[model samples]
Target: EWAKAFNPFFAGENADWLAMIPFGILALILYYVGRELLLSGKKTRA
Candidate 1:
């Protein structure tokens, strides 16, 4: 009963795409940060 109430994708309800926007942005930021760190490391080593 409590689980059903907290579940966002409950039956008959459409999934909320808006809720995922922040997560997508966070993923992009992490990707860029990781890329920069790797590049910096390689440059420093070489």
Candidate 2:
């Protein structure tokens, strides 16, 4: 009941792509930040 209200994927027949949008955005942000940190560390070591 309440869980369904929080998560559309559980209550709906169709896949909830919208619910995953935030995850995708967060993944992209983490990827870029990690990449930048790695590059900076390499530059500092050299």
Candidate 3:
């Protein structure tokens, strides 16, 4: 019941890859930004 209410990928008869693309891009961008920030902090500390 909860799965049916919240799961977008499996909500309809087809999988929603289009809806998931922006989220994937955002995640990758966030990961790279976080990594760069962490590295810059370590360099400044050293």
Which has the greatest lDDT? 2
Q: What's every prediction's RMSD, in angstroms?
A: 4.9, 4.4, 5.3
Per-residue lDDT of 1-46 in model 2, one digit per residue for the tens?
Answer: 8967776766765547767888999898889888795344545544
TM-score of each: 0.47, 0.48, 0.46
The 10 consecutive residues of candidate 1 with the worst lDDT sum are 37-46
Ordered by TM-score, highest first, the candidates read: 2, 1, 3
C-alpha displacement of 18 in model 3, angstroms?
A: 0.8
Candidate 1 vs 3: which has more TM-score: 1
Q: Please give the distance, in angstroms, between residue 38's alpha carbon in candidate 1 and its true position after superposition.
A: 11
lDDT of 3 by residue, 1-46 (tens): 7766777665765557857888999898888788795344545544
How much lDDT does each candidate structure score?
0.66, 0.72, 0.72
Q: How far is candidate 1 from the true structure (C-alpha RMSD, Å)?
A: 4.9
Which of candidates 1 and 2 is the stronger one according to TM-score? 2
TM-score of candidate 1 against the unseen true structure? 0.47
